[model samples]
Target: MAGPLASLKVLDFSTLLPGPYATMLLADMGAEVLRVEAPDRMDLTRVMPPHDGGVSTAHGYLNRGKSAISLNLKDEGSADRIKALVAEFDVVVEQFRPGVMDRLGIGYEALKAVNPGLIYCSITGYGQTGPYKNRAGHDINYLSLAGVSSHCGRADSGPPPMGIQIADVAGGSHHAVMGILAAVIHRQQSGEGQYVDVSMTDAAFALNAMSGAACLAGGQEQKPESSLLNGGSFYDYYQTSDGRWLSVGSLEPQFSSRLCDTLGLEKMKSFALSQNPEHQVALKKALKDAIATRTLAEWQAVFSETDACVEPVLTIAEAAEHPQLKARDMVILVDRGDGSQQRQIGFPIKFEKTSCRAEWIGKNLGADNKKYF
Candidate 1:
C-alpha cells in the first residue's frame, strides 16, 4: 500500500541536519522528494566522518529515499530551472538564512508565483522577521538563548552538552515537518498555500512546556534540580556497583512503594512521597546506597518482576540489541544503490493501513540531474 503522503511531491533546497532531516521524514512516508544541491558547495554531511561503502553514513541516512539534482544557484539560469521544477513540485523546503533565498531568486514568493498552492517551509535559527533573523547560530546557541539549558543539567557544573542535537532535530526538523503538514491541510481546505517560518530558538523556547507554564503563569523560575522530575526528588538516575546507571521514575505512590520494597528500603517510602527537601535528600541517598550495592545485571534481575518504573540505561549498541527496539523494528536495512544494503534506523511512526519504506540510501551528487534537468 502507498504511504499516506505518497501524493505529495517536494523540492528540497535544504542542507545539513534540520531541513534535511525534516524532508527525510517526508520522503520516508512516501513523498516524492527531489533534493537540489550545489555542485561546487557540497553539503558537509556528504563528507562527514564514518563512511560506509565510500559514502558518508550521515548523508546516506538523512537523504535516504530522495532523488538528487545538482545545480549552482549562483548561475543566472538556475532560477528559471527551479521555477520550472516548482510548477510540478507542490512543496518546497529550504534552510538558508533570511534573505539568502530571495537573493537567489527562488524564495517563497518567487516559487509561489510558479505554483500558487506551494507549501514552502523555511527552517532557521531565529525567524524570517525576528530581530536576530540574520544572525548565525547552531543547535547549542538556540537552546541556550531559549532557556532550555537553564534547567537541564547539574547546577554545580552547569548544563552538560547533550549527546544529540535536541534543538536541530526536535525544535527545527520536527517543527518544520509539523508546520508544513499543517499548511498542507490548510491549503486543502482554503485552496491557498502559506509560507511556514520555523524558528529553532522559538520552538526550543516553547519546549520548556511545563516549566515554561509555571514561569509564565505562576512566576516560578525553574532551576536545575529544582523540580520533582528534574532530580529534586528520588526520581533520578543511580549508579550501580559496576558503574552502569539505572533510571528510576517511580513518581506515583504505588510505584514508589514497590520501588522502595524491591530495594529493601520500605522505611523510606514516606520520604519518597514527601515534598520536603530534606526528606527527598535522605530518600535519594538511601536509594543510591542500595542501588550501588548491586551490579546493573543484579539490580535488573531484582526489578524485572517489580511494577516500579526502573530500567538500566543502555548504550547505543545495547539499545540496538534491546528486545523492545528489536520487536519494534527500529533498525532496518536500506538499499545502497548497489546490490547490497546498509543498516539504518527505520521510520518510527506505525500506520494501520499505509506503509512506509526507504527506496535507497542517499545518491551521489547530480545522480538524478539528467532525469530532472
Candidate 2:
C-alpha cells in the first residue's frame, strides 16, 4: 500500500542537516520531495568525509529518496520560475536568515500570493523576530543558551562533551517535521496554508520540560549533582574492574532492594536516594567499590536474570550487532544498485500496511534540471 504522505509534495530549499533531515523523513514516508540547490553553491555536506562511491556518506544518507534540481535564485528569471513552481508544490522548506528569502523575492508572502494554500516553513537559529534573530549559533551554543548543558555533566568534573548534535537533530529537524505536519493538518481543515517559523534555540529551550519545570514551578533549581535523575542518587553509571561501564537505574524501592542484595550491600537499600550529602557520598562509594570488584561482562551475567535494571555499556560496534536491535529491524541494508549494499539506520515509525524505504541515495547536482526547466 502507499505510504501515508504519498500524495504530498515538498519543495526543499534547505541544505545541511536540520531541514534536509526533516524533508528526508517526509520523503521516507512517501512524499515527493524536490531538493532545490544553487547552481553556484552546493551543500557543504556533499564534501563531508566518509565517502561511498566517491560521494559523501552523510549526504547520501540525508538526501536519499529525493530528487534534485539547481536554480539561481539570484536571477530574476529563476525567481519567476520558483514562483511558478511554488504554485504546483504543497510545501516549501527554507533555512535562510530572516529576510534573505524576502530579498530574493520568494518569501512566504510572495509565495502565498501565488498559492494561498502553500505551507512555507522557515528554519533558523533563533527566529524571524527577536533581539538575537540574526545571531549565529550551532548545537553547542544553543544547548548552552537553553540551559540543557548545565544539567548534563558529572558533578565533580563538570559537564561532559556531547557526542551528538542534540540541538540540530532534536531542536531543529524533529521540531520542523512536527510544525510542518501540524500546518499540513491545519491547511486540510482551513484550506489556507500558513507559515512555520522554527527556531532551533526556542526548540532547545522548550526541551527543558522536566528540569526547567522543577525550577520554574516548584522553585527548585537543579544543581550539578543534586538532581535525582542527573546523578544525585544510585541511578548512574559505574566503572567495572575491566574498565567497561555499567548503567544502574534501580530507582524504585523494590528494584533498589534487589540491587542492594545482588551487590551484597544490604545497608544501601535504605539509602537508595537519600538527600543527605554525606550519606549520598558514602552510598555512592560503597556501590562503586562493590561494582568495581567484577568485570562488566561478569556483572552483566550476574544481573541478567534479575530486575535490577543494570546493564553493561556497549560500544557502537557491539550496539549495531546487538540481538535485540537486530530483532527489531532497527538496522537495515540499502542496496546501491551495484553488487554492494550500504548499511543504514532504519526508520523508527512502523506501519501495519504502508511501506517505508529509502529508494535511492542523494542524486547528482541538478540531476532533474531538465524536468524542472
Candidate 3:
C-alpha cells in the first residue's frame, strides 16, 4: 500500500541533523523529497566517520528515499529555479540562520510569491526573531539556554553530554515536521500557506513539561536529584553485582510493595510510599544495597514475570537484538542500489492500511540533477 504522505512533495535545502532528519521522516512516509545541495560546499554528514559501502552511514540513513540535486543558491538564476520548483512542491525545509535565505533571494516571501500554498519551514538554534537569533549555536548550546541542562544530570557531576542530539531531533526536527503537517492541514481548509519558524531552544523549553509546570504554577523549582523521580527516591537505576545496571520505577504503592517483596524488604514499603526526604533516602539506600547483591541476569529472572516496573539496561547492540524490538521491526534493510542491502533503522509508526518503507539509501550529490534541471 502507498504511504500516508504519497501525495506530498518536499524540497529540502537543509543539511546536518535537524532539518535533514525531519525530511527523512517525511520521505519514509512516502513523500517525494528532492534535496538541493551545493556542489562546492560539503555537508559534514556525507563524510562523517563510520562509512558503510563507501558512503557515510549517517548520510545514508538521513537522506534515504530522497533524490538529490546540486544547486548553488549564490549562483545567478538559482533563485528562479527554486521558485519554479516551489510552485510544484508542497513544502520547503531549510536550516539557514535568520536573513540568510533572504539574502540568497529564496526566502519565504519570495517563494510564497510563486506558490501561495507553500509550507515553508525554517529550523534554527534560537529562532528567527530573538536576541540570539543570529547567534551561532549547536545542540548543546540550545539545551543549555533552554534550561534543560540545569536539572538533567547528577548534582555533583553537572549535566552530562547527551548521547543523542536531543535539541536537534526532539526539539527542532520533530517540531518542524509537526508544524509543517499542521500547516498542511490548515492549507487544505483555507487554501493558504504559512511560514513555520522553529527554534530548538523554544521546543526544548517546552519539553520541560512536568518540571516546567511545577516551577511555573506550583512555585517549585526542580533541581537535579531533588525530585521524586530524579534520583531523590528509589525510582532510579541500580548497579548489579555483574557491573550491569537495572532500572527500577516502582513508583506507586502497589508496585513499591511488590518491589519490596521481591527484594525481601517488605518493611521498606512504607518508606517507599513516603514523601519525606529522609524516608526516600532510606528506601533508596535499601534498594541500592539489595540490588547490588544480585547479578543483572539473576535480577532479570526474578523480575521477568513480576508486576513491578523493573528492567535491565541494555547496550545499543543488545537493544537492537532484543526480542521486543525485533518483533516490532525496528531494524530493517534498505537497498543500496547495487544489489546489496544495508541494515538501517525502520520507520516506527504503524498503520492498518498504509505502509512506510525506505526505497533506497541516499545517493551522491546531483545524482538526479538531470531529471529535474
Question: What local distance difference test score does each model get?
Answer: 0.93, 0.88, 0.94
Best by TM-score: 1
lDDT of 1 by residue, 230-273 (tens): 87888899999999999999999999999988888999899989
How many collisions per candidate?
0, 0, 0
* Per-residue C-alpha lDDT of model 3 across residues 97-177, encoded as one tens digit per residue: 999999999999999999999999999999999689999999999999888898888889998899999999999999999
Model 1 score (lDDT): 0.93
Cand. 3 TM to true fold: 0.98
The list of candidate 3 runs beyond 4 A from truth reads none
lDDT of 2 by residue, 1-373 (tens): 6778998999999988999999999998999999999979989999999998888888888998899999889986877999888889999999998999999999999999999999999999898998999988888998888888888888788877788888888999999999999999999999989999999999999999999999899998786777778888767899999999999988888888899999899977778856776776787899899999999889978998998888889987788888888887777776664656677777778888997888888888999999988
Cα shift from native, residue 120, model 1 (Å) = 0.7
Per-model TM-score on C-alpha atoms: 0.99, 0.95, 0.98
When summed lDDT is taken over every stretch of 10 residues in candidate 3, the lowest stretch is: 226-235
Where does the lowest 10-residue lDDT sum fall in candidate 2?
332-341
The candidates, ranked best first by lDDT, are 3, 1, 2
